[model samples]
Target: MTKTVVMILFIAACVALGALSGAGNQPGEWYQSLNKPFFNPPSWIFAPVWTFLYILIGVALSATWYDENNGRRLVLFAIQAALNLLWSPVFFGLQSPALGLVVIIPLLVSILMFIAASWRENRAAAWLFLPYALWVAFATLLNLSIVLLN
Candidate 1:
């Protein structure tokens, strides 16, 4: 099994799990209610953006998983993924942006560590997470806004 193949599997797992965790958040009800920041892209933008991001994450992890798959970076990759899953349900389903924001802090930190660690293992792979990191930063701001507005 090639490392790329393994990482692809892992990335696919993240997206599949993420979508499942978000199953309860109906777009009609949940998304329509939120007070999005002015900077928020059209609601339609999320799927594609995350889709691309998931691919990148997969490449990144697969690269790391390719290298050794037995390091702290690999573990952090998993941790960040778990954190990613929690954000959607917390914010959209429970309608608790505050708690979601709280949860995301650790997620954000985990991602940073993932990037740094992945960089040490594979610079290209680390770069793969850059968009995800940026998106999360944007989301943190957006989440803060939603909490404040609603």
Candidate 2:
């Protein structure tokens, strides 16, 4: 397949997975009842922020996928993405902030590893992941706060 085709596929894959996860785990009454932290962002912010991040991550992964040395980085990216997908189900579907924290911590670490591995092969790819890392870091804290408060 052509590089462009592969890139588009990656983008589609990320968006599809995100949409499916979001659909499966809608934040309804269970989430509304939880005691959120003072710093918790308004619910409206999540969609836009997540949309942007997922796009960045999709591009980053596409860039890294073409690199010959991307095996480990791609593996890390897949692991992190799987963990990312898992978080919504565990936290929202199952209604367990504590489990979310458990999943997110490793997700953050895998993201860091992915960034570090991608840096050597493609700096742009690594740079694309910075915001994702920061967001997950913030999310980890948010998940922690939720667990603590509730």
Candidate 3:
């Protein structure tokens, strides 16, 4: 397959997997009852924001896909992706914001590590992860706040 085709597939897969992960682990009454911070965004904001971020993440992954020396980068990407998918289950499915904090902190670190690893080799990939890093950082703070508030 062509590089463009592979990239498109990667993007689609990221979005699809993310959507699937979220679909089954929605924040129900338990989440609604929790005391959220003042800055918690409306529920409507999450879908679009996550979709955009996933596309960026997919692009970053595609950028590094063909790298000959991508072992470390790939590991970082996988670690972050796994942690990202794991958060919803821990936070919403299990209704444990404290456990979510545990997952998200490492997730944020893995994202930063991915960005740093990509910096010298593929600046585009690193730049792509910047938003993901920022969003996850915000999410980490949000998770921490939720844990503290409740």
What TM-score does each of the candidates earn?
0.88, 0.96, 0.99
For 35-104, candidate 3 gives per-residue lDDT tens digits of 9999999999999999999999999999999887999999999999999999999999999999999999
* Model 1 regions lying over 4 Å from their true place: none
Q: In each prediction, how many residue pairs overlap at the backbone (N, C-alpha, C within less than 3 A)?
A: 1, 0, 0
What lDDT would each prediction earn against the true structure?
Answer: 0.80, 0.91, 0.95
Query: Between prediction 1 and prediction 2, which has the larger TM-score?
Result: 2
Kindly list the per-residue Cα lDDT of model 2 for residues 28-143, writing each as its tens digit. Answer: 99999999899999989898888888888899988998888678888899899999999999999999899889999999999999988887789999999999999999999999
| All-Cα superposition RMSD per candidate | 1.9, 0.9, 0.5
Model 2: residues with Cα > 4 Å off, grouped in runs: none
Against the true structure, candidate 1 reaches a TM-score of 0.88
| Error in Å for residue 98 of model 1 | 0.6
